[model samples]
Target: MFCYQCEQTDRSDNLLLGCHSVKGNCGKDDRTATLQDVLIVICEAIGQYAVLLREKGVVDPTWAHRASYWVFTTLTNVNFNATVFQRMIADAIVLRDELKARYEAACTEAGETPVVPEGAAQFVPDPGMAGLLKQAPLVRVDANIDVLGADVVGVRNLNLYGLKGLCAYAHHAHALGHRTDETDAGIEKALAFLGDPPTDLDSLLGHALELGSLNLKVMEMLDAANTGVYGTPVPTQVRVTPVEGKAILVSGHDLGDLAAILEATKDTGITVWTHGEMLPAHGYPGLNKYEHLAGNYGSAWQNQHAEFAAFPGPIVMTSNCLIEPQPSYRSRIFTMGPVGWPGVRHLEHKDLGLLVKAAQALPGFATTDPERSITVGFGHDSVLANADAIVEAVKAGDISRFLVIGGCDGAKPGRNYYTEIAEKSGDDTILLTMGCNKFRINGHDYGTVAGLPRLLDIGQCNDSFTAVKIALALADAFDCGVNDLPLSMFVSWFEQKAAAVLLTLLALDIKNIRLGPTLPAFLTPAVVDVLVDKFALKPLGDPTEDLANAMAGA
Candidate 1:
């Protein structure tokens, strides 16, 4: 029951260096936690066959998407029901076994022997809860720590967690009807590497970097998937306040599901509001065209307990960042995709009519709240549209620098650093933000620069691609390397998705990035030393001091 895959992981400097208690920070019990590791073991096995079958060009992309989805369910704040995981275990085994059979046949046709993975890689879960619990110890995340030192374990887990986050993005892109063989094979290749479990730190760390490169392709597909459906994001101001009517709050980063919900509720009198990462949906022309798509309702995922409870209508979690649903609203709140809680109702295949019913039954927004708004939809295309102005502003020194200071936000201590950095930036600097980290200081006025808003909201965490594209365009416009541009990155990571983003930055050879509030609990001082030495990565210090140093080109 040990885990440290998210920012809110226990860091008491204990033996496990993670949540070894009955309940984790996201309210995941030990039973569910161990079962998640077991599921991952199955994924590694699937990947082992998937990689080979892919080479033979016989693997099904649906299975790869399934494997990626299984990884997404294991992410922090996603699924918490042990019973649901039990069924998933059985289904994953069927999937894994199907791949195993194909791999054997392919080898037979090629007249070559297929080497099968052993131990957890090919583990068969024993029947009943007792048998499952008994098998859990063999596949725990730290199972290799005793044989291979902590350093090797740390690097291996880094690669594993990076794959988890990268797969989540892949799942998102696939949901939007986007899939690529190259990325699918890469995901399987990563799983196959983890199946063998490397004992060397260098091999593990190097693979982590390769994962970063792979994530770029996944992000590009996701960017295409979104723009292809939504007709490219335009700068649109979204109301941050509530309006009068029956309401339904849709959270997470699934635009496809959100569109379905909108279609289902077109005339039901339920006004839909985007929450958490879904706030960026307003900027999309396709979504904005819906007359009942009201506005944003809450801040970030961490505040869901209070916000969801106080809300007037039923809530729908489209994908992730779900916490324990309170008794107050548990009955009305519904889980979609991989999100599940023991008692919370689950929506199947974006069948949002259930939410339409729940919202109509409840009182929604007693009256329209005061008007307030925030700007979003600064996708690469939107930003690049004003490329001429931005390049000229940079050359004229009107816009001194760009700061990317956002990632997944958490409920842990020290996150105020983001708020401080944003507020402390000089008028000459432009603030670019993504993920829930923007909720920390986005509501504050930072004023405009270079004939545009100083703080540009770049949609969700996946939109980190947009930020990178903007930087690259700037570099090309100025005829310099991306690293040579007057830019600085400060990443605030809470979960594995953020890990994938950080790895992408590192793969690009981008250096001098700062990370905090604390290093990942899974990483040892040895792993940190390697990052510090190679990438000039540093732990964040005083925000004001760091901002000043960044401005001075330090």
Candidate 2:
């Protein structure tokens, strides 16, 4: 097994670059790791076939969504069930063969000999696990590194990983009934690029930056999907304390499934609560309309083992980042929409009947706890609507600087750095946060300045687009470019999606981003140097020192 798709990969001597042991740092075992690699190789072939069909005016938009799902399913800690992958693999092969036949026919009609491809584009998976495992070694990440050099391999992986993260965002938007012509074409184009990668290092690096530009468009699609379906997010205080009643904790990043469950259990007296990244659901107008949709229930995803066990009702994980459920609550946990564990019940067709009934039977928190809450819904619309006031605050000395502290959260040791920075931020500084990392320092009371909450909670990690929007709006209000604005980004990354977002920032020529709690292991030293020299990327150091550096020019 070999995997280095996330920040938490093994770093022990001889394992600095990736994990080749029985299990990855995130608990993915050998079989699952090998199957994931095989699945990606299959996706590349599927894209190759799809692109070939595009030459005949046979554009299939659904393939883009499918490609998005394939990449999303391979993200770290997303899908662990090998059976699910096997089914997807079988389907992809059938489609590939069908498209190949069509492409060959097109060539024959034109009196041209079709060139059959080798490698991943023409792979035929062996029926059994042994055969599949045999093919895995040939397609693993390190397969071409020796010949292509680490710099080239690293840049290629950057594009691949960025595409994975972009597809994850695109998948979420597709769930809400959103799609566009460019989004579809871009998805297939990027997948096919990876299907037949370029050998030139400069070309690969250029494609990586192109992915960053494409991600910007993907993020916009998601932004529209959320606001159009759920109504623009508004500032609303979400209760962190439990209310009395039978509760169902909806976790992960799926707002659609949460909406369904809320509708299903509206009159049942079984209250609905959010966990992990689902915390932001409380701010959306469509979701907030449910009176029974109670407040957030847990901290970050890493604390789920204890949090899920302690909760009295069933938990529904609608998306990725699902860990191995403890035996105590594994019986009550339900997985849906690409998230799976060995023993947990998988919900089909977004059904919550079984899980809802379980919640009704369980004795939920019988009494209401102390009222403690946090204000959310500071999305792009919310902040930009008050652009004039924000600009005035800056001019009047009410606001000194702005800090964008957002990204994925994890169980790693250095995560306290986020909490410290947010805490140490002066009253004159406004903190804007998103993603699960907000859980680290969101509870603090940073008083409002210029009629805005000091710490603004932009929607989810996918809502990083909101930060970009707010930044540009602020820059426009002050008549300057984004880089010239008094804003600093101290991002925390734990997974590939964060890496993709970082690439997007660089693609926009937005520089001076300080990334932490650790850099990606997939990036060799040479690759890191390129990013530093080109984009002014910096690593997180002492909180005070980093903060000082961030405020130096503000």
Candidate 3:
């Protein structure tokens, strides 16, 4: 199979042969490869439209949303259906031709080679036919370097993956009636860079960081869109035990779907419980006010197989990570947005009749357990509102340090480090978390500091924007730079969004972050050195040792 969705490949060529000898690696077959090809074509087409819109000073919400969704769907492990992808490609090409014609006419009137959309697709010349176009090229610069061995590929993977997250967030914002010209332009520019010819390892590394920078802007736009529409998150205590009798458990990261579910279920005698990243929805002013909005059920995505199996009612996944649904819970598992698993019901539109019917048919959720409550919210707004109290706590030595330990939670057992670190952290320390990864420490009884819960679940992964906001606010309140604040980021990364957030932190000049469980396969020594020297980035070590270093450094 031919593949080149990332920057790193063998023989200075963008394409690579599938390692047929190795099973489960890449999990790609010929069909998947073709689908990826189609996806690249669609991205190019979308890029072309995006560039046109940018130049025309007119933004099309539908085009922007569709484009972003296309990019996100191409992310690794997201969508593998060749038929669906090909249809999307067909749609994209149709749109591309229409936009190209419009652009060409406008340009002819003004006199110039119409600016080929920022991320426009290029036809590759076939080696066999001299100049004849063979097929469309993948959306990655041909960084044919062996400089850092597999590290180059790793960096490439990181960049592409981060773009996927950026696209996903941008798509979500578009859905919410929020639009930013700068974000739209950034997507076009970044996609164009990804599809450019390969440069040096250092240059690619810079692009990786740039992806993070752009993601920050995208995430900020999403943060504003979410908070503006839903109100700033406040500290909330959500119950873990299902409310006895009929209920629905909603997972994944789509707030819009969650809101819609709440609305549809209103006065239906069905209690709504949250799972995974959806747990933090409990903090939102509008969501929290739901009388039937019970509490969170599971911790993170990885534990869903068992947790979901044990769940008492129908479960809906708005956008799950690595969806490996067990047959036991498969019928109860409903997918929405881009998330899908064969045989699982997918609710893509606002219609929740199926969910309602399923909830009504099922035995319904169990009663809320008084002993099982998980506190949520603690987002940027809540944290900043309590900035004075936090400052006072710090001044009084009640809080000596703050650690941000949150990112993608994977099934790998090594992730236990996060829980261990949280459990062992000093009583005077504050743990700020986001994403499903917070489940690692969510169950820990770290108590509180100055009426503030020690562990703060700041919402979904995109809420990393809130983490940055809190850091900046704290720094400002303390009359010092962010690096000077008693704050440490020990992030766990498993996908592109994590890469983007890491880059944002580096861009902000936040130093000495400990990243792990394993460093990205990307990041050549030279590139890593630049990060180390410039930002003091370090790989995570033993929890005990890292904690000591963190406290000592603070």
Candidate 4:
């Protein structure tokens, strides 16, 4: 098996390229990796037909939405159950076949000859698990790397990973009754191009950037979905310390599941605590109204092994970044949506009867912990509403710059760069960020800039639109372009959602982005050179040096 789709892909001395051993850094076994590869091949095939069917208006968005959610399942740290992947593979083939038939029928009914897609789109998976596993090596991500060269394959990974990011965010939007035809069609179009990939380097790069531009729209849709369902988030104080009660800790990036769990357990003597990306839910008016939706716990996804094991009650993961569950907490931990682990119980249709029972059966907090609080809910609308004061502060020298440091966080070493950068950003600079990356610097107090909180936690990675919108509003208030603002973006990436966010930033023509813990393993030297030269992107450097350069306009 071969995989290098995330920031934590094996990069040790021997295997320097990607994970090729019995297991990946994310703890997915070889069998699950191979099955995901097989399913990825299916998503490409579905894209080939879904793109055309969308154009013809032959079928509704059933297949397009299905393909989007299906690809999401293959993202890093999402699903680790090989048996679940086997079932998804079986179901995907039948879905792809039905989509193909519908596309053909639409062409025939219109009296036009249909052109069948070739390569992965036309091929069918072998029967059963063993046969499919046998086919896995043939369709692995790097199958054509030797022929197409690393540059071409690198760009292809860009497109494919970008597709994964878009689909993952789109799934979040769809969950909140938000859907846009353009976003759905763009996902299919990118998938179709990847099905029979082009060898032209420029075409591949352009397609990848298009996926980036499209991802911005998906992020916006997600922002709208969250705000439309829950009220727009406002500045609010959230208790980080434990509240007294039988508690349930809900982690990951799904607010819908969090809201459902809150409603299900309302006044039942159980206090629901948010974790990881779910920490920002405390700021939403709709969710905060529940007296029992108490406080956030722990840090980012990578720290879950320790935090989950210590939590006194059952923990629920509503989205990505589920690691191998420890034996101690395996039974009490539950998986929801596309997140899955082999022995962990899964939550379906927001049903938490079993989870509720588990929560009651386990001992919760014995008493109230110390009152520790952190202020969240500084979303785009919230920041923009304070635009006048922020602009005034910048002009009066109260705020020197806006250092936007954010994106996904992982278990790697160099991630401390984000921490140091934010800490040294100084009180004169406003620290803007989102996702678990904030965990690096949020623990320290940078104080306020112009009466506005220094570190702005917009929300989860899904709330990326808020950061961009805040930047644009700041630029507008300053009467300058976004690139001209005194802003420096340092993005820490761990998975595809971060990939999507980077693409959106690049597509908006944002420049001087400092990306790290390391460049993606999938990017060859040539592709890296091309990105650096084209977008003026820079690899992460020493925080002191980078900060000086950012201040000196280097």
Q: Ten consecutive residues with minimal summed lDDT in candidate 1?
A: 115-124
lDDT of 4 by residue, 1-554 (tens): 88999987887754348998889988988899988888888888888888778778754666667888889999999999999988998898998888888888999999999888987787678877788778776788888777888778878888889889899999998888888888878887888888898888999888888888999899988988999999999988999887766999999998888889998888689999999989899989999999998898999999999999999999999989899999989889999999999888899754788888888889999888779888899998888888889888888988888988888998889999998898777779998889999898888877877888888888888888998988888888888989899898999998998888888888888989999989888888889898899988999988999999997665
- Whole-model lDDT values for every prediction: 0.88, 0.86, 0.72, 0.87
Runs off by more than 4 Å, candidate 2? 14-16, 115-119
Q: At residue 468, give the lDDT of candidate 4.
A: 90
Write model 2 residue lDDT over 405-451, tens digit each, in one string.
98999999998999999998888999999999999989889998888
Taking the tens digit of each residue's C-alpha lDDT, what string does model 1 give over 454-524? 99998899888998899889889999998789999888988899999999999999988889878898888
Residue 484 in candidate 2, Cα distance off native in Å: 0.4
What TM-score does prediction 1 earn?
Answer: 0.98
On a 0 to 1 TM-score scale, where does candidate 4 land against the true structure?
0.98
State which candidate, 1 or 3, has the greater lDDT: 1
Candidate 4 overall lDDT versus native: 0.87
Q: Pick the candidate with the highest lDDT.
A: 1
Q: On a 0 to 1 TM-score scale, where does candidate 2 land against the true structure?
A: 0.98
- Model 4 root-mean-square deviation: 1.3
TM-score of each: 0.98, 0.98, 0.88, 0.98
Kindly report which residue stretches of model 3 are placed more than 4 angstroms away from their true locations once superposed.
1-30, 56-59, 115-120, 124-154, 366-370
